[model samples]
Target: MGFLPITKEECEARGWSQPDFVLITGDGYIDHPSFGTAIISRLLENRGYKVAVLAQPDWNSKKDFMRFGRPRLGFLVNAGNVDSMVNHYSVFKHKRRTDAYSPGGEAGKRPNRAVIVYSNRAREAYKDVPIIIGGLEASLRRLGHYDYWDDKVRRSVLLDAKADILVYGMGERAVVEIAEALDSGIEAKDIGWIRGTCVKAREIYMDEDTVLLPSFESIVASKKAYAESFALQYKNNDFITAKRLVEQYAEGLYVVQNPPQPPLETLELDDVYGLPYEGTYHPSYEEAGGIPAIKEVEFSIISSRGCFGGCAFCALTYHQGRQVRGRSKESIVKEGRRLAALPGFKGYIHDVGGPTANFRGPACKKQLTRGGCTHKDCLYPAPCSQLEVDHKEYLEILRALRSIEGVKKVFIRSGVRFDYVMADKSDEFLRELCKYHVSGTLKVAPEHISDRVLSYMHKPNKRVFEEFSSKYKKINEQLGLKQYLIPYLISSHPGSTLKDAVELAEFLSDNGFVPDQVQDFYPTPGTLATCMYYTELDPLTMERVYVAKTMEEKKMQRALIHFNKPENRELVRAALVKTGREDLFGKLLRGSGRTQNPYKKEPPLRNQKEKTRSSGNRGGQPLKKSNKRRS
Candidate 1:
């Protein structure tokens, strides 16, 4: 019912000489379900296992790792809830000054590649004990992946960490199975048949039921091989149809990944959320200002897991898969009531949603038994005819939360899929969302306005966003609410040239919307966009794509999104001239007199052949210009 043991004193208080499992993490111990370490540790405890948390251990030596001594089962390691590379460095590869998951928001608490470092330390402390690694860092990098920080393809984290087993994805099922197997006298390396897990193999035996990806050497030597391997991994993610995958390394060494574990049913999901969580950071960290990451999730309730809205830049599909799973309405309402009773209970609940907020069930009935379509997306290109568009269950859950005692307001802070909302025939959810969930402004991601770029991102076209915007305005107007829409946009994505950047700038200008924050494309590991960025070819389609790789070009693209700002005028002008759109420079420089002439004369237009050659030399091959701007 209280916090888990983190030190030798706490372990003694529990009257245990050695814990059954020692969970070593790179984050401050926060007993919240939102934290992956908290979930796994608590799950083991509930099953009568003596679990001790060794959080943010001193990796320079084995001293801190020896605090818990040796565990009866094994040592479970994770790089906290986020990938450590993302937590330590910004998109520009600059070292971040602070870590929100650390106490006092301090940086350098955990070293680079925390999983590998901690695993090595654990091995040093007890040479023969089994070491297991999980969490986002290990999950996405279970196989050979492109490392953004290293700027090269690296071998599986399982091989590099020298850990016995690597559990990927939402790890509740996998963790329990591994624990049970280990308790039954099964060794770590021999227990390779479990789902959602990867292990190193010694032979090249092949099975007709399993899939063999490109070998590590081949993938490293050829970009095309890497793309093909990633495409196979992407398709075989669903639990229903996924096959065991094998990747070969040098000297006939291999890495074998089992199929993903099936998504939890409603009752199973309820049990995971119903664990006894302390719901706050460990008391020892109070003097260090506690964990800053808890502030965002303290009052929020996660209603669902997984996403069906496939975005190329997102890694959710590879991590959480495409199936949608939700907890019971009763479970959510109970959590909301418990949150209201917390010491600093406020009238507002920050958010009540997951990956995509409005999703309450699977996209269609067949997905429950057959899994998602491999070649097509549910909501991209266009909504499939079999897609079920209903938000009644989600709406009812929100209504129940609104009626809870001491609850004054409930906001949907997690993103809402506006395109999904538009697909519904009934407007009840939209009307009520505008009436209650609008906290003055609702945020949505219409990442870019160009059709060409949208295709590459696997996002809906500009017209879909325009239609959703119009519908949202009409509903807000009908309810007499002055709610504004704050759209999130991205810049310098693969297939986005200087011309596409200008098109997006014009869209923002015409709408009189200035984004407070703009996201430049970051090529993280295991995403389709990252593949395109690295190879200059779409993994799904082998066609060449233009990529803005240079710092100067990326800066110009980002500046164009905020062209109205006085500081960005020069960057915006330079972009327009470079793209052979100098005519738009006057429009961009109209208000700011920083340039010599507000209305610069336009140069003579180049011939079609000349324009083609000029644009091809800029980044990659030139894309066909489309005039389908949002009206």
Candidate 2:
């Protein structure tokens, strides 16, 4: 099939007066299943709807928004794969220099709060037509959320965007249901009861089955209320157990969010991936370096969706839900074969996993029917006895991909939950992973070494990571592979203090490694950690969390983590003195500019050998551009 029309001329060439749905996005058009725009548009087209794409439109005026000439059904808007503000700025609140989603890796292509901007402009162009917003930005801010950019709690994006409805989560099921509803002649405002949607209620809403959260006014007035509100929203994310949630705005008007749509089963997931995607950036971008985001995903196959590993800083729990879903091994193998045939295929499949690489299905059998428990996490503090830890299916898919012609190596760059690997009864997956999947280094995110800080991050304790590391090394030894472990760490998380930062620095030093990059906790919407960052309270426990909010502290945390770097000596000194650990100066820093860190003794493990980084790379390579927390 030909690509979806992106302009009026293309729409006419397809013999359509107007598109049934105009998939408006904030990123350059890449018809790859990895992109939400491609997935949703293809789903609509499969249902016989004429879908047009309006990607990275000119939001300063209504001209581009009107180019589709009033979508026959409605306008579906999103701020692309990543949130726009995050896409534009770094954790230090500095404007980012490049946008992988833009045409030429340029920044500032999309406005701040892109969902609100795009929706408003679409409304300006056609005030009467329905404007439905979804994707990361809209989905995260679907309720009264703490906006880090604004440093305040803002009402739902539906109210601010003047959108008819907001679709949250993995939106395939929700968008299609809404489209069918609209096709049957339901007005957008009247279409309030669809699952996975947030709509402004015309009348005050009260129902026995629906949950009521703290009002926007209440959350704004009190941080405790905000924490409580976030906690309530987090708990009701399960499709089987969740009730319709309503948040009060004014007395008469409310925002009603229906229970999330049920996650697609295997056959349905297969169909979505089986769509006729062109598997590359739209040709219109050829002159402008071709959406840099496509480079990371073009050779990748998304074998699954959703994550059961509930990390506090991640938004997956809020967006993708805890329930896991997977495409059949046949479906993924087909995609891998197609990737091999692509013009630039070089005998490498970049990735063959999803949110969590090893998770091919739900964490346990009960989750498929009963849903994930709201009270406890799947893998945090400790793994539940009932948690089903299996990697046999994921292994089969990888083995099949490796056997495909023209495929040399299948890498698991997306990441694996080290704790989950430890929980499993079998070591077969780890041994195979060490033998085949890992390139030269297996990248795992321990996030932090301090148990105190890790508790706040909802990550496994330092011991868990250490145990996993030891096992990985043993497996690599048996396979005679000289592989290493590149552990990803985060600093200045919600409960992190200067002491915690110092502990992490010492751990890195003792391990004979320093991170090439360190991630500071960024406060974005819709995560338990973000709520903790704003409210200074663990919304889950109502206990106060120590947060390092100032830029100075954030920098100090970074200085400590990379204390071996000569440039960070002063910052490290400052951090040591401030944390009342001046004695650490001698241990953390011992020499002049030539040999800044006098190398700690190494363990017998090969991973302990330190090699100089030429261009800020850890070991094998610099992180892929698409790398996020198991994203």
Candidate 3:
């Protein structure tokens, strides 16, 4: 069965009678956990509301309305995209041939009624419906935004998608409240007062109006200008420039995001705890008919919302906020016990993590009295000179989790913030983490190696990561554990030019790391990075630097991390030469002088049987019935 099994027939059958609500989903690709569509759909079903999902639907089609035929109450249209960046901005480059189909043969379309539309195309389709577009894609882009792929600044999705209201962040609580309001006979127009949502017309804009039309002639042109613009607005926390751009270019643009989503009760594992979880490296191996040798099978449960660490390039903090709300320890342990009882339980628990796994407490104790620490980071320039580090309660939770009966090894696989762990009052927690929780490698985010780049990204000094890595390694060795630290690094952030990338490459080479992976920075909307990309100035310092916007430049810097590898040497070497850096090309890349190409592979199989096997082995399309929503 797929994540949330609500079919068109089910809805049509239910629509013949009165039901409390109906959920309509625009799930592009399914199976990803980040999308809250599945959970919300299931939650409503659990609450006795007859719900049906329109998975990976063509929201623009009139026939797609059968999913919500003459519903008695409200219609929820959710563009299952996890973040507004993906929804407002386009990333169609990755679209495949099979991306156009909907599950169950498109039979679940909603019927035209005064039904609510939560999908992004509300304005273009079902225009008169009580449209409510809520999700990261609509929430973050609820105002005018710089569309990276389109190379133009566009109006808010609420305004553009023409949804009457835009909901942001986790929508469970807000949606439930909306259901109650609608059930009580309140008009959809009255929902503007709901927190964590934005509505047009009724929601007044008190923020300044500032709008600049991005050059739309070429993505390269917009990328070039946007890259420069992003560097300027990053970390400045000045809404003035953005507001000005909106007012000037998009006079009618406005957004209303009430308070952030209050943290929900930790998810009960009762439903998913007993399911067969296959933890394969590939995100969708099982649905593709491939069985992995090492499956880390367990449900990923989110314990909190938002991250306190205000990394400039990240849009999470901007939407989820720095404040964190945690699930009760009992709820977490209950889920653990349930999972331990699953049929596929192998005594190995895959992970228990969040945005930053270990940050389980409030940002600071002074939050209630002083309204939280306005400071961006606690360990950045110098360890928050006045802050207190507490890991006692947090560590207790971990220890209690390990004590669960059937759980053999409970791992913390989420990217853990090293600075936070190092600052804990005692190494006891670290020791416990090493002794019971870890499964060899710990994933951590250092992001970059250069001080300038780190500062521009609003990250802690490289020294902090170094210190944490050293301590973690020593502790592992002392415990006689055979494990390694797998560090995650990114390239081509707003201020990270080729020079910075080169320095990062050199650092990786010096440290004996072959640089196995690198994430090329993509401009995500509602992020400081997007502004920097457009403006090219340090959002705070008004500083400018060389911005790499070309595909060639991106490939060169991306390959720089893997230049030493034989397979990538030629492509990387050629890129270096193209940059007029032939000197470093030969030095860093092998086979540069010799014509022999070590990276070359054998010719394609011409044998009939081999070809047939290869063709048969191709990964099958994922189950389209999935209710999972991905941005």
The weakest ten consecutive residues by lDDT in model 1 span 622-631
The candidates, ranked best first by lDDT, are 1, 2, 3
**How does each model score on TM-score?**
0.94, 0.94, 0.76
The TM-score, computed over Cα atoms with residue i paired to residue i, of candidate 2 is 0.94
lDDT for model 2, on a 0 to 1 scale? 0.85
- The numbered model that scores best in TM-score is 2
**Clash count list over all predictions:** 0, 0, 56
lDDT of 2 by residue, 269-380 (tens): 9999899999888899899978888888889888888898999988889989899888998989988888888889999998887888888888888897888999999898
Model 1, range 1-631, lDDT digits (tens) per residue?
7999999899999899989999999899999888888899999998889999999988999999889788999999998777788777766665667778889989889888999999988998999899999998999899999987898999999998999999999999999999999999999989988999999989756787699999999989998999999989998999998989999998778999999999888999899999999988999999999988888888889898888888898888898888989999999999999999888988899889888888888999999888999999999988889999999999999999999999999998778988889899999999999999987888888989999999999898999999988898999999999988888777899999989999998888777766655677878777899989888889888889999988778878887887876555666777887888887766776654354574554343446344322222222111110000010
The whole-model C-alpha lDDT of candidate 1 against the native structure comes to 0.85
Superposed model 3: Cα runs more than 4 Å off: 1-5, 8-16, 28-35, 42-48, 58-60, 81-128, 202-297, 372-375, 574-587, 590-631
Give lDDT per model, in order.
0.85, 0.85, 0.54
Model 1 alpha-carbon miss at residue 230, Å: 0.5
